[model samples]
Target: MVARRNWAGNVHYAARRFHEPTSVDELRRLVAGSDRLRAAGTGHSFNRFGDTTGDLVSLAGLPPDVTLDRDRSTVTVPAALRYGDLATALHAQGHALANLASLPHISVAGAVATGTHGSGVRNGNLASAVAALELVTADGDLLTLDRDADGDMFAGAVVSLGALGVVTRVTLDVAPAFTLCQYVRLGLAREALDEALDSAYSVSIFTDWRTPLLREVWVKQHAELPPPPAGWLGTTAAETPRHPVAGLSPEHCTPQLGPPGPWHERLPHFRLGFIPSSGDELQSEYHVPRAAGADALAALDEVAHLIAPVLQVCELRAVAADRLWLSPNHGRDSLAIHFTWVGDAAAVTPVVAAVEERLAPFSPRPHWGKVFGLAPAAVAAAWPRYADFLALMVRLDPSGTFRTDLLDRYFPRP
Candidate 1:
């Protein structure tokens, strides 16, 4: 059999067998019979979190089962469905999700499980929108957990990293469809970062760290708001389209230049039809308290010389706090500093470690789906509810059927 690799082609799965079950019954049977298994979603994660030595299952073969409850303001979808497809379905019905990650191509289950997010000071990470989810556990039993009914355990489960079981379905909060306009500004001063971030409904700052000035500032504002000023913070609006990563074609990016568009179209940085980001790249992100945003940038600046060489681009965005135990933005309103590095792991690995070391003072929590060199203990210490999540994992998956080497490292079996 051929090898299976993730979307970035950085990590290869070690599963002895791969299974695609067309029905929940078939998926249950596969889970019950296997000594060990791990569910693979769109394979967008860059790490080994989805790797296993036993069986690997993909839920893409199952029915999408998209259902919207206008009364409850929620939408239920199959776990494997991409956010882009789900957004299209929701928008068609005159509804929309509160927020989406930069790349809408990710699977709902994977994105939620790993605490993926989009840019906005008031927006919570994607997992914060989960209202309920259904999963098949080690015993082949279908279990459903609701945000309101399950309380703390549900909070712990939302960003579970696939340790509890295979999430098959998810119900997310929705809102009336809305529209927004995207604006791109160039050459923002470093000191004006906070004001620029809060200047719009959703904002993204891009820089290569080679200069003191920010290279690009993408502002996404609600359509109802007045147009941005001709010149603010000494930054000029882009005369033409711009890519987050310098020099790349802007064709893949979502519409920009202050034209009003659907929330789904303007909220995400990339268009649904295009491959997100530069496809051949490795990503790493850390969330520090919003109050520490400036300090965090200064910390990263210390290592800018090392980072700029291997980096494609660096983005800084904000995310509101949420209750999800494993989420990087948990407890504290956060400033997410994201790095898009060249695909060469050998060269990029040390830079990642250096970045982590510089940001260690702020107790940064790394995005679970991305590349990071932080030690297991350091990572566990960053999450206050880490122990609670570990206990919840053991109670739900006693036999560890869903366990992977990555999970085992952070959450050791007693």
Candidate 2:
């Protein structure tokens, strides 16, 4: 119980008073009694950001109550609903989320709070799909937020990272459901990221320092026909991003049609799914200005000497720019660079140092879910309105009822 794996494979001190509350009433009581508490969902995060010293809250068992608003084209789901089930439920109602992550196993609340995103040039992160949310704040006070009202909370809640409150339910903007004609291709050199960048709506390449040559690229085109009738869906790994370590880098993985089906298939690389080529690997993802992609790639490569061997894979993804304060792609169209490692995290962390060291001019936004040893000042430096957000948090949770050591890490100094 002390040691558990998050989706990104980071471990830390877990909660002593872990609970799955069935109702707000039970949660209020639990929250009121705890000295230190944190809510966890699927343990899919990369760092101990969810780790707590005294108590942990697991929302997996909560009853899922889903509601659809046909007029507004929105779906409201309990915070605990797995993204997989949420999508399926939404589909049955003749609706689908605006876009979904590659792997749909994550929780809607957790993903949005952390600004989880899938590759897309025009689309936005999952948090953008949120139209409204019900949050239980520090004093166990329930509050509602949306674009039309409580705008400040709405801005903070979109990517709150659990700092503002415990999200209870989320109302997401939905679109007419559709299917994708998927193809995974290899060969987008770290250098060619610019040349081939605009070819697909969503593209992700997996590789590490060992091969500067991009290893795997997932390509998809919207299709009217519902997913190619079984066998025609391309079973063998012969297509793109050929599975089973192709180059000097040996990845322990087998390529199949795609696991976890439609939902989990969205994000095929992360855990609660396939582990990709490297076993027990560590990962780091930094989102930088899209213009700096080439430069960022060059910087990551500079650390190849220290990172080449332990590096299992690196992924490149593009995201449309947005105005969200804490968004990694804030104010600029962005490229997310990922580093997957084959060995020790303590050893591989230096790679992050090198990437950060070289990318100082770019001022990259670190993925909230990955392991990177940058101080809060550095983290907040990437987010301009972080100070305002802190002020807002103080106003809303002045008692610090929702506070944790992790929260202190970000707000304590200020």
Candidate 3:
């Protein structure tokens, strides 16, 4: 049998077999009968969180059903649906999601489960929009959890890390479709980041840490908002489109240079169909308190030499805090420091360790789906409600049929 690797081609899944269930009933049956099983969504995660020693199920073949409730301003979609496709459908129906990750190709369920987020001082992570979800549990019984009525338990369930069950459907809050414009500035000084950081709707600063000067600052704004001065932020506007990673063709990137377009199109750095970021890259992100942005940048700057050797690029963004228990942005507004490293794991691991150590003082939370060097104990300790999440997981799946080594490593049965 062929071994299946993840999107980043890093971890090879150890599943004995892979199955694509065409219907919810088929999915439930396959999962119910298996001693060990886990769901795979679009194969976008960089780690073994989705890997299992038993059956590996994909909901891709499931019907892509989308039901809209215009009165309640919500949309119910199959879990396997990719955000990119969902965004297109939502726009056509005159609705939209508040934010999207840097790449739109990820499955909605996977993105929400991993706490994936987009950049915005006011916007919460994608999971924050999940009003409700349905999952097929170990017994073949379908279970539904609502964010509003489920109370504290729902907060932990939203970011399940593939431990609770096979999520089959997700209901998300929607908003009136809107348009945005993207602007880019090149070679801005590090000091300028403080003054210009929260000045825009959604701001991202991209750099490689090779130099003290930042490489790019992407400013996304509402179409109706006035444009900043041409020489705004003391840097020249990019006359043409620019990719986040230097030397790559800007063709893969969305429209830039102040052109107004659908929010779904302009918000993500890469266009839906194009390869996102560098095709050969490993990602690791750490979120620190929003106010700790300067200290975090300085901490990373001290290790620039160690990082630049294996680094592809580093991205900086902010996310508003939410109530989701497992979300990195929980409790406090955060500044996310992301590293897109060259795909060499051996060379990148030490650098990731150094980064974690440097940011340790601030209690940074690592992105769950990406590569990281922190120990399982440290990760659990960082989340105050982690013990509660573990209890919830055990209560939901006592047999541990849906549990993976990844979850067990970080959250063991208490």
Candidate 4:
């Protein structure tokens, strides 16, 4: 037995043992022997979603087997492979993913499991790229689900929260390689951002919530298109590159200033080898339907005083809707409000609660892997397909082998 903590060091996993299997056969054996277990990837999750009392398994030791199907325009990747590494390899082969999150350090399976996303009105969350997956169930049996063969069930399985089983491999759709350029605008007014939100391929607006204007706006545009508008909402285009969080060296960030680069290099904010975001930070995010965005931000502004002292910065982005049952953007186009806090959980919890309460009227859906203060009842009420997801969980893991305190606490089984 050994002790392990999550990437943020905020969650100390309480597993009786930790296992890293080098092969699917070995992984199956571990799953079959444990009555209660959970799988984690790269420890990127901030909370206890990947913790368990019985055993915690990771597939990092397993060989990364990446294959491309030319006829299908898809690539099959090992669950443990991080997006940065996978993107590099795919780029070498003249292929690319649709979008990437702000950081490229997270595991593919872990990110999809928790509904991690990138910013784009036309782009879906990472899970939406999944075309198929292979997982080991409670009985140690391996099952594969393809989007073509299993429709609705596949939607639920992509954002499974590690409840159904340990995901082993994922098949994702790809497109011909492309190039993009990033441009930064300083201090854009709220109305200006609204007008240009859908003007670019991807847009990210950063703020501290203390002012009516946003601090920075990063717009990623296709190399083939014209540049973004200048002098928007009292904000002007930046001649030099800048980090998402003010004062941080732009060297650590991806290339900017309209220089065309490979899609993988320009899509994310931080470069692959550099540290991503403020290292000493806690993250919390909520997704509300796009129509409620204005009201939601207004509500958060009402509590800006409560949020600022504990916050590093806040980011706003939009995500396209998908059919995934548990996805925050499930059924409605979403506006995501994210916070990077000052790393003091005690000082941040109250603020998190206050934000949740203020946005309750919008029925915001919390990010599964991030810090949240929603009560169990509130959580259960947010997802319209919660009951269907619960039923699916039962069918996949009848013995509750993958259940954890995190799941049981918020979504208790009957």
Q: Considering every candidate listed, which one attains the maximal lDDT? A: 1
For each candidate in turn, the TM-score is 0.98, 0.86, 0.97, 0.98
Query: How many Å off is the CA of 376 in candidate 4?
Result: 1.4
Model 1 over residues 236-291: C-alpha lDDT tens digits? 98999998888889999999998899999998888989876545999999999999
Instruction: Please give the distance, in angstroms, between residue 60's alpha carbon in candidate 3 and its true position after superposition.
Output: 0.7
Displacement of residue 56 (Cα, Å) in model 4 is 1.2
Candidate 4 TM-score, true structure as reference: 0.98
- Which regions in candidate 1 have their CA more than 4 angstroms from the true location? 1-3
Computed on alpha carbons, the lDDT of every model, listed in order, comes to 0.92, 0.68, 0.89, 0.90
Candidate 2 per-residue lDDT over residues 182-220, each given as its tens digit: 555554455666645575545666665676566666654
In angstroms, how far off is 168's CA in candidate 4? 0.1
Error of 1 at 374 (Å): 0.6
Write candidate 3's Cα lDDT for 240-359 as tens digits.
Answer: 889888888899898988889999998899899987654578989999998988988898888899999898889989899999989999899999999999988899989999999999
Number of backbone-clashing residue pairs for each candidate, in the order shown: 0, 11, 0, 0
lDDT of 4: 0.90
